[model samples]
Target: MSSSPATRRMSASQRIIVDITDWNRFLFAGKPISGVHRITLGLLRAWKKLGLPFEIIRHDPETNRHKIISHRFIEEDFSEPIHIGGGRIEYSYNKYVQRRTRYFTELAKAKLRRFVKKKEVVHEDFIEGNYEPQADDLLYFCGAGWDAPETMHAAHKWKAQHPGFRFVVLVHDFIPLINKVYRNRLGTRQFRRWFRDAARSADEFICISDNTQADFMLHWRRCGGQGVPRCRVVTNPHEFLSVSDTRNQPMSNGELSAETFLANRNRRYLLTVGTLSSHKNLERLLSAWNTLNFFRDPEADLVIVGDNDPRDVRSLSPIRRNVFLFQKPPDDILKLLYMNAFCSIFPSLYEGWGLPVGESLWFGKVCLCSKSSSIPEVGQDMCPYFDPYSTEEILLALTNALFEKDYIPSYEKRIDRGRMKSWATYGSEIHTALLKMT
Candidate 1:
């Protein structure tokens, strides 16, 4: 995908326009940052730091239009500290309030269906102005876009209006499309529609890993997509979050300090970071721990840190006493967890790029990971791996990692941090690739 020197430079009037509609939606809903969001934020930060010429735009679904967004606006929002209920009682009370709100909302919805005429929920547009596209500008969606049909429609419209404009979509994974079990009927249908629309609208595509690129091509052919667009693989940064990042700020009074939290645990805990989604294979990992009777050890524990789903929590009910779950932990606490953990584990059955594996390895920790999909691309031979499908293999791997005295030390010694690319490097490479495409 290399371009000749002549076409690698951007003209004075040209600029890259980043679409962060997904990020805005998530922020409005008070959602926790996911891996994809982190990747987008990292790139944005890198580009800003390196003085890359770029403008930010967000597609307003309510207005069915795009608007210019300032980088400072997003940066300030990220800089604000997160407030999660810290104490056990406060956390319990917050959970109670959430449950009550959900229950009443559902009840009201049921009543309204029976007694009231249904009407469309109107939304007020808060964005100041609509974005007018420049012919030479590169329009890119770096954040999640599968759920934004309106945004995709707008992108398609713009591409048609401005023939010289290039619209690029970043494909994270084909999980909902490839694996039916991970999503419901409605979710699967939505994803199918999104992929078709996104692929149809884009002039070019970017995949997080080589495996993801292969998956994209396979599905593109299956769907009978037209002439292939220029696609590239730009693996995400492996570096961990630094203190300068917004998430590393001090917690509020209600939240537990990492040092105090670890002191309370008073045990060497193994860390696993990721949402308890079906694709994460948490059940298999838990089974491996159970089979080894590792939970019976008083001095050892398992720390599960990630956003939690009610259905997933129900499915994995009656969690072991030694298995402590920290739902939606702040980044600072998470960093300390990684720092103090005995080791880390990533048992995801599939991923575009197993970020937790890279994060674990970044801290010089041995990450017992699944040898599936794009996971191996993140850790390679630096960490041990096991088949996510087989409980026997998971058990064996866990046993070896726990029992072997030199297991963690051996991996730490070989961690070659020099090989890991920083976020600035990742952004620069992507910027260069975009320039070449133009």
Candidate 2:
């Protein structure tokens, strides 16, 4: 029997079109890319592995044109996009600048050469006006596809001219549409307009979580979107392990002191891993953590590991001496943190899918997960659920996690199941869906 529904092998005859506009934007603005970027990249790599006939395309933001450009993704294991660092290189200390000088110089030369060779075609990737999309062609917008609405608008006209041109969109979440407080006024308004247009234009839909699909259909009907395409709920494939699997390794990283290290030896740390934002409800966790009677559970510390908003940290009720924020930990350190942590906590009030909750289970650690949105779908019975809105609820969960040795009653099944959710499986599911369109 096949391990997954997506396990069927794909043939090379499949002529699928993919939107890759977001990839270039991510490259230039490279400051720790989002999960969307990672998912898109993983999907592309998976499709290529299947050797299914496909065209990689993107719409030119400047020219409003589109074309298939497959050559851009030949390299793999992309090195960290050179960080320019916080301070300007010109005024920086010599030692610091010298360390990254080679990267900066190469980047400068590359940009200079592009500028020097400027042509009428600022972008060479634009689709020629004469190049019309073929009938029976499938356009898959797997990313947010910021220009999806615009493409759908133009696609309607193109479909009238040509035939059998269909577009499939992947809706990650309805956070912006459903919750105004989640985003700023301008961003929320922009997303609403864009989503409304996308809803009207897209021929079909796929949602990462059930919450997203239900909300999308609700909005589509509410907004009276056209030709409401069939929506599929294909859960995301999570290969959360680093290429270098560091399981079973000792956690003796020298970042912590002898005192903190000794303290951590008794019960290990409580972890929360994800980019901190307003929606994550970390402030409440911090508030609850502060109020916890450390006299009873003094050994445990709360270790937050991810890129986070400084403002959120600053606004924390009171910075606990035991609570440490480890911003942007590398893959190795992160593995250790996950492996050795006593239990993971996710107080996120909203998410397309709570990756940390699954990751915690994947590492065989207990999770104090929220009962909000699609989080429960990821956690199931594997994690201890808590109301993210209530500090008391969070505090109680924390206490249980710290005091109760058997907080996660049974999670062995979850750990085993999470391993089958691979990117190959994800790619296979996506290909199967594409074939259905044909």
Clashing pairs in 1: 86-254, 86-255
All models, RMSD in angstroms:
8.1, 8.8
- Best candidate per TM-score, number? 1
Q: Write the per-residue lDDT of candidate 1 for residues 120-152, one digit (tens) a residue.
A: 222333344568987888888877786455467
- Candidate 1 error regions (>4 Å): 1-7, 77-128, 242-259, 294-299, 309-319
For each candidate, the alpha-carbon lDDT, in order, equals 0.71, 0.65
| Pairs that collide, model 2 | none
Worst 10 residues of 2 by lDDT: 87-96
C-alpha TM-scores of all predictions: 0.82, 0.77
Per-residue lDDT of candidate 2, residues 42-141 (tens digit) = 7777667766557776554333456556434533333244212222112111111233577467546645654675732333332333224777677788
What is the lDDT, from 0 to 100, of the residue 203 in candidate 1? 85
